[model samples]
Target chain A: MYKIESKEVSLYYGDHLALKNISLQMKANTVTALIGPSGCGKSTYLRLLNRMNDLIENVKIEGTVLIDNKDIYARGIKIDDLRKKVGMVFQKPNPFPKTIFENVAYGLRVNGISNKSYIEERVIRSLQNSALWEEVKDKLNKSAFELSGGQQQRLCIARALAIEPSIILMDEPASALDPISTAKIEELIYELKDKYTIVIVTHNMQQAARVSDRTAFFYIGELIEYNDTKEIFTNPQNQRTQNYITGRFG
Target chain B: MKKIFSRLLNHLITVLLYISGSITSLIVILIVFFLFSEGIGLFGKKPTEDGFIMAVNKSNTVNHLNAEQIKLLFDGEITNWSEFGGKNDSIILFRMDNITDYFTEEQIGENFENLPACISKVVDSIPGIVAFVGKHYIDKNFAGKELQVDKITVGDFMFGKLWFPTAHPVAVFGALPLLLGTFWVSIFAILFALPLGLATAIYIAEVAHPTVRNILKPVIELLAGIPSVVYGFFGLVVVVPFIQNAFNLPVGETAFAGSIILGIMALPTIITISEDAIRTTPRSMKEASLALGANHWQTIFRVILPYSSSGITAGAILGIGRAIGETMAVLMVTGNAAVIPHTLLAPVRTIPATIAAELGEASQGGLHYQSLFILGCVLFIITMIVNLAVEFISRRNRRVAS
Candidate 1:
């Protein structure tokens, strides 16, 4: 069974159709990268998995979104519970105006895990998983704003991991950071796929080639192609995908 | 040539602007100088021409008595002339009135027609006689000598508990009661307004539907635009009667009535400022909280409210400044009793109300007039401090946000 599936999903913002009928599935413990040019509905497709699109006004979704073979869009499903099982990081590093330790520990506290030792352990382990533990362990009480832009993004990743969700969604998570920080995040994503099903949206074609095992290219609200990263990069089955990857045309 | 003309015009405009700005600054400086110069004069000793003079029989050894001795002697607390290095004779007090224990209206004639003659006769007949009369009533040819009075002191003006601005011997300038009343009403007004204003702000900013917010915002702003006297009239007609009927008091006007009116007046300011603060929180921050599996209420309390805490505090301080400087509504509803109120139900007078009520009746260049200016100075300082506090808090919030 697939770990996550979107069966013929379509979405609309007011009268403007943002995403067309799209079907995709991901196996357990695999990294999937969605790549496209700007306003191509790649980020919108990623947001559909965790229902983050619900926060926007005039949003309409049609079709089934399932995780662990259960329909997330079905009635009687709690949105908060669905969100707890699928953690998301934004394009920008938006940390709460709080200390670094508190930023990481917020998810656990909100989930009603009151044990002090458990929260402390989870925060530290999540920091270590994001490779930010050694740099921040000595000053966890300092404000999250004191960190550089790259460190703040990694801290946000650590915040997502503290909840221990089975699926993690990243929307251009490293697009705002420098090259060195982008490589660090790519390396961290490579390690994270061993335990969590990771889906990342990227604008950089090279980034999708470096970090993803499977790749899907979307164009004008339609999924143009999906295949193994090596196959899509080496041998193209679609003309548009070839044109995009070769930097000929978006 | 046109370019040169435009440049010359620009220079002339600059000069005009400078002159206008300097004129405004100069006027402000001159007002401050005038207010301080006149206000500070209240603390010094100056002989006022309108006070009562104490006259003796000329044989009495006491030539001058201090303010306290005069007060005590007139209050009937001192009955023996021997207390002041005089002959050990029984003291006979004389006052300008229709009837007294020492003399009757018949003996002094109807309407006290021969008041000056009667006073001269009384002083010449009794060696220990001490008479109190207006300075204009004292006859210079009589066999009595006028005793010199001492000047009023700053300590007496500030700390004296009584507030009778038209009292005999001297008009008391004691300001403790008015100051306390101002603070008392303002504190109660804040206590009444803060919770209501903050809740309305949160609802409008976070919980209300868009259509509801659009309607509610303008209605609240309309509350601010209503004239203060209209509020005073509402307080007098509605709130005053309601309080009196509910508590069964003899009079309808009380400090509680004033607090209710001022609280209503301050709500718009508090609500508008706090709502703006809450709405300015970045959308991404809110999304981050919600996406972390936190509910909307949790996100508001944990993230939105904490981020906007300084703005809310500034709003509250500004509300308090509005309540403290309010005059006409307080003057109309607080019963205008110049006494230190011991309870919310008691009649009281605030400083602004006192200045507004009595400044008209106060004689120009007199002690009462100068004291009113001093009250204005106190109000200016209080408002300035509150505004500075608001500036400090908002600046600190900006730094933290950055």
Candidate 2:
């Protein structure tokens, strides 16, 4: 059974259609990568999984987005609960202007967790999972801004992980990072799929091939192809996907 | 020809911008120098050896005097007249009345203008004695002997306890309470304005839709441009009555009332600066919070408010400086009483208001006159401190942002 599914979903920004009749399924505990050029509705489609599009004004979404067989857009669905289940990391690292410990513990604190032992344990576990604990454990009380860019990105990932979401959404999460930082994030993504269903939107084809289990190609707001990452990279399926991957055209 | 025209235009623009920037600094320096030099004159020592102490009245008449035969008449000494050659007359002392012109007809009397007539009247009314009065009140209609006028030595004036420096014993202008009152009122005004103003800024910057923000932002900004006198009038008419009625007081003029009005006046500055700061918080921060399952209130409080805290603090200090420096509005609403504030509801006098109310009629070189200048200097120092604090906070905020 699929962990998350989107059926015939379309989205609009006022009168302009942004996504047209998208459909896909993501399996549990696997990494799925969405690759597309800018403004191809790839990010827009990923945002719908957690109802993040609700924050934008005049954004009209159609059809249903389901997670764990529950319609996330249904009337009784709480945005906060949906977001908790599906955590998101942005392209740029945005650690809170707080201590390293507080940055990772922010979500827990916001959820009204008062037990210090529980928060401390969860923060350590999350940091260890994101592979940033060793480098920053000594400076947990230092401001998050004190960390370098690469460490800040990892800290953001640790912050998201501390919430214990079943699914992690990465919206071009490594795009703004340097080569070394990007490699570290890709490695972290590969490790993350063991415990969380991951959906990443990336323009880097090599990164998608390296880290993702399944790959979906989007063009002009339409889903061009979705298949196993190996198959998509090796076999002839869609001309547009081939062209985008082969560097002929975007 | 074209090259020359453009060059000429460039030079003209540069000159205009430079003049605009330098005008305020130059004027401020001149004003400070003027106040300092003139204020320092109150402490100038006189060379004259002969001296006699004289008492004056509100009528501007000189009626009694200490004979020049005496070595000296120090301040707080000679409370009675028998010591000064008068027949056991209690020396009636008159204050400067916080009026700017010590020699003004309203301050002295509508009828009397010189010391001699005042002395004649004093002698006729109080029997035989000597008194020092305003120079404007001097004439030969009085019967009492005119004592020699004692020049106010600089040393005596500075250390003098009382502020009666008119024509005889130069009054010492006490600045301790007036300065304290100013600080208290301004501090209270900032305390009142900071939170309310920042909340309004957050609502406009982060929460309001375009339409609501457009409508409310200008209205708040317009408050900063309103003439302070108009605010004073509003405080006088509306706020004073409201406070008086609500508090069951005899009058409405009070420190609390002044703080409220000044707070309202300062709202535009605080809101504008803080809103700009909140607006400039990186959008990525907002996205980060939202992605963490944090609710709108949580994100606003945790991220937006903390990020903009320094700017909000800057706005608050600027607002406080404005409140402390305000003159007309405070004078109208604060009851202009130069006493230390015991409660928010009590009437209070701020430094700027005290200076404004008293500088108009105070003697040009008298202690009362120079003390007002000193008050101006105090205000200048306070505003400079506030600006410096703002700079420090801004630099720290910039470092954090980077």
* Winning model by lDDT: 1
lDDT of 2 by residue, B193-217 (tens): 8889988998998789999999998
When summed lDDT is taken over every stretch of 10 residues in candidate 2 chain B, the lowest stretch is: B63-72
Which CAPRI quality tier does the interface of model 1 achieve?
A: medium
The digit string of per-residue lDDT tens for model 1 on B47-146 reads 3345567788988888876555666676778888898777898777777662255576787777666667777777888888888787666666677887
Q: Of the candidates shown, which would achieve the greatest DockQ relative to the real structure?
A: 1
**C-alpha lDDT (0 to 100) for residue B201 of candidate 1:** 98
Clashing pairs in 1: none
TM-score against native, each model:
0.86, 0.83
Which portions of model 2 show Cα errors greater than 4 Å?
B15-25, B43-170
Off by over 4 Å in 1: B1-20, B46-160
Measured over all alpha carbons after superposition, the RMSD of each candidate to the real structure, in angstroms, is 4.9, 8.3
